[model samples]
Target: MSHKNKKISSTPKHTIIKALEKAGGRPKAVTEAADTGSDSEDNSSPENLLTPKDVIAIVTKTIQSELRSIVSELRSEISELGSRTDVVENQLDVVSKHQQTTDTEIADLRAEFSTFKDQLEDLENRNRRNNIWIKNVPESISAEALPDYLEGLFLQMLPDLSKESLNLDRAHRALRPKPNPDQPPRDIIIRFHFFKTKERIMASARNAQSISYSGSHLQLYQDLAQSTLKKRRDLINVTKVLRNHSIKYKWGFPFQLIVSKDGRSHSVRTPEQGLDLLRRLHLIQDSDPSTSASPSQQKTSAPTPSWQKM
Candidate 1:
């Protein structure tokens, strides 16, 4: 048929349009049918028209498109969540490291503070025990002169301490004893006191009878003097014996001695004796006296002295 004179196929248009209206008013089938079919053609046949399956397929496709869009959005949200989790993990790591560092710093500071506190305590202990505060003494004074001088000096200088008599002993009980076949001598030690003079004097006198002096005259001043020369010699001899026996003895710092029965019997070893004893003990070698080398002997018999080496 001539295109100008062709009749319009209103039947196919009507059928497709009716079918589209039943399927939620979709215009796709109507437009496609109108564009492809001629007015003279039998496009109205049911086989050529839109079917139930085609309508269902179109609906499914539309749903799939919407679902795909929703899936993309969900995927984006999941990716964002993952990123957020990573950030949280990083933050947690930073916090954990910071806590560890802070804890270490706290421990270091605590240790430093403990060290400072220990230093302070040591200073306080030293201040309490330091004997240098007693003043106006001669440099030339010997250890033997110290007890009497300091005792009188204390009475005169620090009278507020108490109006007490000072007692001095040249020989104390702690000294090493000398050994002699004729006389079994006792050890010598020196003692000094500020307040307990009578008790010390009595104790010294009582102990004097038991001790052997260098001479009988040395025993005459037993109450005033500490150990006699005989007793001191015996002490040195005993010290040698102890060395021979492979025993170690060390002189400790002079300490205050308080009698439990009476405070008046309290005494102290003069620092001079303490110093001398310490020096002497220091000179005592740890070597086996029976076998080991002696510095004195080595010095006398040096193959070559350091002076000769120079």
Candidate 2:
């Protein structure tokens, strides 16, 4: 017999005998009877030692053990799968909350951006109504010079008017004045950025009745009016007429301009006082009659107009 076959033949017989003995039985009797039915020519065959039933019983027990082990391993794998499922659910909840928070923050930023855009548009519209004027002045008149003159002169006209004056070497200017006899006066033009100051300039025009500015020095007031909306409109009617006239005035340093025949001398209000002479002749008109009258009557009984302050 081959070695491998012999070992296989002995394996079933040995397993059956061991199981039968443990049960208090003889595996040899069953094996010997089983071999007689198998029609074995050799009576010394190894199959005579055991029966098939005994072998089958041993294999059934072994199979049951293996099944139990497989069942236990399957239970352990199921438990691990349940734990993994819980972890996945927790991670999903966290991701969902984070996405909601991110969405809310994005919405807030969009609202803020909209508000900022509206404010920017409003500022741009307001700037359109404001204007600036400048004149190419002589080198002698330093940048600091005109600002001082404007501060002193305007302060006298409107003591309550709060304003800041500046004379930048390169101030922004616009050409909106009508063409006058001088074409474009190249002295200097001051500017006001805020539109509200325009009302103050208009008020100055109406209150300059007591002043007289020489024709040669008229550019100073004209430049001021052009810098603001309210004053520009008030001056438009006059500018149109003066632009058509062709007349030049003499110019010199100290300018030797007569501010008022009333003999009131002060740099604080010289320009306004001079404008009063040209525009509001009513101030000088009433004065001449009273002075021309008898000196005794003027002092004793002359009544003052409501326009003049005591």
Candidate 2 stretches with Cα past 4 Å from truth are: 1-50, 124-310
| lDDT assessment of candidate 2 | 0.45
* RMSD (CA, Å), each prediction: 24.8, 28.5
Judging by lDDT against the true structure, name the best candidate. Answer: 2
Q: Write the per-residue lDDT of candidate 2 for residues 54-139, one digit (tens) a residue.
A: 65676577567556855776677778877887787788767767766776787789789966754564454344333333233333
Assess the local accuracy of residue 59 in candidate 2 as a C-alpha lDDT between 0 and 100: 57
Alpha-carbon lDDT, every model: 0.44, 0.45
> Tens digits of per-residue lDDT for model 1 on 179-285?
44455344333344432553344335445544322222223222211222232333453345445555454322222222222223323233323223434545343
TM-score of each: 0.31, 0.31
lDDT of model 2, residue 81: 79
The TM-score, computed over Cα atoms with residue i paired to residue i, of candidate 1 is 0.31
Once superposed on the true structure, which residue ranges of model 1 sit more than 4 Å away at CA?
1-49, 130-310
Give candidate 2's root-mean-square deviation (CA, Å).
28.5
